[model samples]
Target: MNELPSIEQIASCVSGYDPNALPVAQAQEFIARFVTPVAAVESIALRATLGRVLAADVVSPIDVPAHDNSAMDGFALRGADLAAEGDTRLRVVGTGLAGQQFDGAAPARGECVRIMTGAVMPPGLDTVVPQEFTRSDGDVVVIPAGAVRTGDNRRLAGEDLARGEAALTAGRLIRPADLGLAASLGRAELPVRRRLRVAFFSTGDELRSIGEPLDAGCVYDSNRYTIHGMLARLGVDAIDMGVVRDDPAALEAAFRAAADCADAVITSGGVSVGEADYTKQTMAKLGEVAFWRIAMRPGRPMAIGRIHAAGPGSKAAVLFGLPGNPVAVMVTFYAFVRDALLRMAGAAPEPLPMLSARSAEAIRKKPGRTEYQRGRVVRGADGDWHVSLTGAQGSGILRSMSQANGLVVLRHEQGSVAAGERVDVMPFDGLV
Candidate 1:
């Protein structure tokens, strides 16, 4: 519930800054400073909480295991009874299954109990010798010396989660493992943030929808499809507003409708200086928009602002105007929009780790702009991983993005790279 610093205050912190040509890191920081997590919360069934952000911290009401239990199918006995240098023979008094425990008192001295995995530890027993390490003859079991030490294979109560402990904190995006943990804690329901609603559309007279017949000069709108898939991966409630023509009135209507209903409005195309399309003009009419030429390859032109509805008492929606090129749209989305959307959806900020790998070929580059080249990483027989750039690094090359498994990131000051040189890569498929 803390207030975020104003944009002017944030910008004052950056040195040698120029809004005309912003640094990638500085732009990210600007966007991050403007984000405020959503406050709406809802309680739903545990299974349905997957992919939703936790609204409150989940405290364990009881110990995780609730009792001391055996971690393996073995013989449970007092560790002190085992001979230090020789085998110990003892009579097995009872058997313990996962859900059932020995009914009588603890086994007498020189006696042991056969225990299954998850079975509660019998009283006075503090260790278990796995069944593989023991020999059984009728009711007699022989435990080898030093097979297991005290507390070995015996899971103590609350070992995983202690009662009254914070099992999962707020702002966490619930995952499968988290759901299982909640169920283990006897929680049938959970409180999670409401899903963020994102509405997006493509702007271009030459862009056609899937069902429309393609003309000689027009291309099917793949940007909307790509954007839809990417938004789905973020678990947002996506509102797909079909392509809007490059007209001021049509663009204004789309922006207003999107701002009225959704938390964010994302548009691809008409932000670049050359495009000169009416998108910029229409966005200016609706809200305060800034066009920036970021020092980055594939995606340099971007517009960001907050669009307000026409009527009073209406909430404003964040706007992201991305470049029109197929690959550029995706790059900008991943680099900027993804993180902004996550923060807006009530999830805590967690940076994705960049992995290092060797380059398979020399790459051309400039020293000023940052570059994110699509790459296909493979493991060599030498037990090392190397990455080769996709056939084309052009902004328009959609195939390059499709064929790549990761993006080889070159920093702003980095120059051309030599073959077999180490590079940082952000993989596509992994926990984010």
Candidate 2:
């Protein structure tokens, strides 16, 4: 356990750290500065590494190809044998298949060998003309005048990756392709950062867990399910603590238990102003915390800091107090908690890819606060991507989020946009 700087110290270092009306970017930076990566590493099988973070650089143990090989199924011959003006014919000495090297006598001066893709380039063969390019007359193959030049269609030893070269870097988020890369290097196991255990629950007296009977004026807690799904995508161990009613003792106990068992704690609801919930008070009583009215729409109220378990020398967990609205919870997760959790899990800092899309309709936006509106993006007749709002974008409306494939990001310092104007879109296509 390392000594982390107090939240006050972190805020003081920021240029304009205001708890009220803080810009989205500033809040991101403040959280980034305060959170630290977990220092545990474990070696796991390649199959289990998807979404895990690499703890160390992976250097290639051997050349990728290991030897000069053929990249196409063709006839292998010396480049000089290729005529510059007319066709050149050569005798076929033998045939080589992939993984079966040609072991017979090397072709004499005017001879060639038929080779398949992945077959090791035989001695003295420096070029491969696609089998389709050459005409077969009896046992000889004819090459056209300009079919290929020296080194055409030949994969050299270490051409793709050299031995001892860094193949995969540290802090890389493991994807399926990365697993293939590691497997190509003959790695059965990979060193990855241990997954962070995160505990989360909903805070509201009117909230009920699924399968529980809904009372008058109460709703089921959907934020936990969303939080669980999001955490699963990040490859973290998510602990759903269910809903905590507006009781001080229960809230305090939940916070302590969550902190004691996990690296971070998330609570959706009861972080807003003038809420009769005891979540805010319980958080302050446990550890260092600050509430922020972030300058963002769809999600604004946020609490970030650390909370420790009961007893001396207790481990502290990073806290993320999100707003109650179902849509607000998801929006705030993507904007803030996603990055913070990635950092805590020891993954590299990677911004979600945002693409440009033209607006299908006029959108009203203010300059100071950032707004994320649910949008369905599609290709317009002009062949460029265009986005239209998902109907009824209230924060409590989860159906609007379900209908959206992306968030039309109207950035801070940018105002209203007219139809056909270009805007940035944070797509959800590959976030899974």
Candidate 3:
């Protein structure tokens, strides 16, 4: 195994380091460099490969389709049979169905064969005319002179995938289409990376898990549940450690336990400056964690580093300390932790595409920080995509996030946006 470089080395490589005003791209690059993917592989059934990372490249064993076939229910005939400046007619010698062959010698110059969709082409036939384009009269079919060109509507052998061609590359997350492709290649099972194990918890004295009676000064803990759902969507093996109170010993123990078992640890509170909590202090004692005031609204405070467990045979886990606010936790997770976890799970880097849409209303934005506002995108009467804020943009307002289908991303150094201006949006659903 290659040893990972320390954060100090990574930071030194950065041209300039600003602890209080880090750019989103810089932070992402540092984190990507610091993370190491898990090195484990397993063979699983094709049906169970969905969302799993492919460990090895898959090469096709045979040609797809295996033979020249008609792509439509058409008449398979010689291109030379097409007459110039007039209609052409030929005798329909025989019929060919899928999985059945035309029983005879090659068709003559004035002869054509009736072929169905996916049926292998008859010998010496190189073109197909759709059945609809031809008129049949007592085993004879007539076709217009300019109907089809040579090799039209005919799928040649090995057209989709040739024998010995690489079908799927390594380090790819198997999706629905990938599963079908593997099945078509006659593969019963695929080699995939083992699922990444991640343990997460919420840290706050006033935080309570579900089912606990509401106290006078405390609120229910929703960060843990939200984090759970987010991790589940990433297909990671999650270990929810419940809520860790604001006690030094309790928080340290939780960190140690999490590092001992999981490949990574995520906590949703206690990293902000001027916050009266022991989560940060306990984290420092247990690991090498750095608290940062990122130049990003809604999720400015974050902690990233690695924590080590005590004694021999103990393992170390990467730490991600996100802000306490409900929406901030989600924003930080999607922007940072999501890709980090995907990398640690042995998946290749796949950047999410930012689509542009018109803004429905003016937005108040400053110049020095990145902001992610919950937005609902819709098609306007002008037949163009327009986006408007869901509701209140507070980091604690979880309802806005629930109602939003995407986020209007305002990058650093960008000023206020006017109505009808094009802005970048990151969608919540669809291809990641």
User: lDDT winner among the candidates?
Assistant: 2
Q: Candidate 2: TM-score?
A: 0.96
Q: List the residue pairs that clash in candidate 3.
A: none
TM-score of each: 0.95, 0.96, 0.97
Better of 1 and 2 by lDDT: 2
* Residue-wise C-alpha lDDT for candidate 2, range 113-142, written one tens digit per residue: 999999998899999999999899999898
lDDT of each: 0.89, 0.91, 0.90
- Residue 277's lDDT in candidate 3: 90
Better of 1 and 3 by lDDT: 3
Superior candidate under TM-score, 1 versus 2: 2
Q: Can you write out model 1's per-residue Cα lDDT over 1-432, one digit (the tens) per residue?
A: 454454466678777657788989888988887667778999999999999999999999999889999999999998888888888998899988899977977788899999999999999998899999999888999888878887799999998999999999999999999999998888999999999999999999999999999999999999999999999888999999999999888998999999999999999999998775899988888876778899999899998877877843357788899999999998899899999999999998688778799999999989988899999888889888889998989999999889999999999999999998999998898622
